[model samples]
Target: MSDALLSLENIRTDIAQYHILKGVSFSVPRGQVTMLLGRNGVGKTTSLRTIMGLWQAKEGTLTFDGADITGAPISARARAGIGFVPEDMGIFGDLSVEENMVLAATNGMPDPARLEWLFSAFPALRTFWKSQAGALSGGQKQMLSIARAMIEDRKLYLIDEPTKGLAPAIISTMVGALRTLKQQGATVLMVEQNFSVAKALGDQAVVMDDGVVVWTGAMAELAESSALQERLMGLSMEAH
Candidate 1:
């Protein structure tokens, strides 16, 4: 992929005595949403951690924007315009919503334009500005997590299951926000289990099984093929 902003080639990782992400490889295209999908325990989160340098890759290479980042530090990755929204949301429970967003800004101050856009995208953030993050609802917390990542202008965003445990309404709002991000020219690599949401937001799709890529193609093609979706997702149509 010549236009890939983030490329992972033969990536491998291990945890203690357990080996995960065996020879995983893929490329996330610039200014588009690429989805990583698979069953549970299929090295989804591990791959993200390795890319962020939270989990060291024992082998293979990672390149971001034509620069080798296999050995880059976590802070360095962030400084290089890579933003991450972990599964746990990674928010300060004790801090106010406004305070959390302020802390995520590169210079410790959120840009007024970006802040206004965020408030418009997630009105709850504006409403709960002074409220602690721990007091927010699940959907609001997810919004804050994403808001924090977007506080800074980044080249790529790595978000994990943003709709997990949220109501249908909130999920709809999240999907719209993700689409807007792509429209704003921010490349996105996301891991999601919801077939509907994945189809809605993904431009490219990669399916992983047993720590390696099993399938890769356009999201529209994957959405049209029930057989392929079942084979990769390990679930029946009714379940999905």
Candidate 2:
């Protein structure tokens, strides 16, 4: 974690009586996109939730920007420049897209330049500015969720399965938006099952199984080795 912007060491978490994370450890490098890839129920989402303070770590430490944030509140972590996009795409369905964005702004006002850039990245957001978020399509809602998180500048983003169940066309849009995010030098920790999207955006990859890291390497390496992909994720990238 020498140059890491975020580091997690021996993190342990429990949901009810079930131990979800078993001493998970990883480092997210500054200005790079790190992919967390694994089969379902492997603690990938749990790790992100713990990092965002949604679930308290029963043991171990979480550090962000050289400060220990293991015990910090979710709001404090957000204030420290940590942004989260949950697997469910947490959004205010009843609110207008514009209103949702406004609410996500830290100071009650978004930077015009950033808003402009986001709109360009996901044009449907600007297209449905006054519409209710619930009325939008699946891909549009995903765009809104990610756009809302970008309403303010963030140092690190924890995004879970942004392209979970979308059409190929919409996935392409998501890939474009993520490319824009990478170009802006955003530090991202994303949980993705889509191998194509992970390959396109990931600088590094972490493969997990049964709540522990099984492999850590470059995304290119994972992309190139079908045997490794099958061993870790239980499916080859070609099937993805």
Where does candidate 1 have its weakest 10-residue lDDT segment?
A: 231-240
Predicted model with the maximum lDDT:
2
Off by over 4 Å in 2: none
Q: Each model's TM-score?
A: 0.97, 0.97
Q: Roughly what TM-score does model 1 have, to 2 decimal places?
A: 0.97
How much lDDT does each candidate structure score?
A: 0.92, 0.92
Per-candidate total of colliding backbone pairs: 0, 0
Per-model RMSD to reference:
1.1, 1.1
lDDT of 2 at 213: 92
lDDT of 1: 0.92
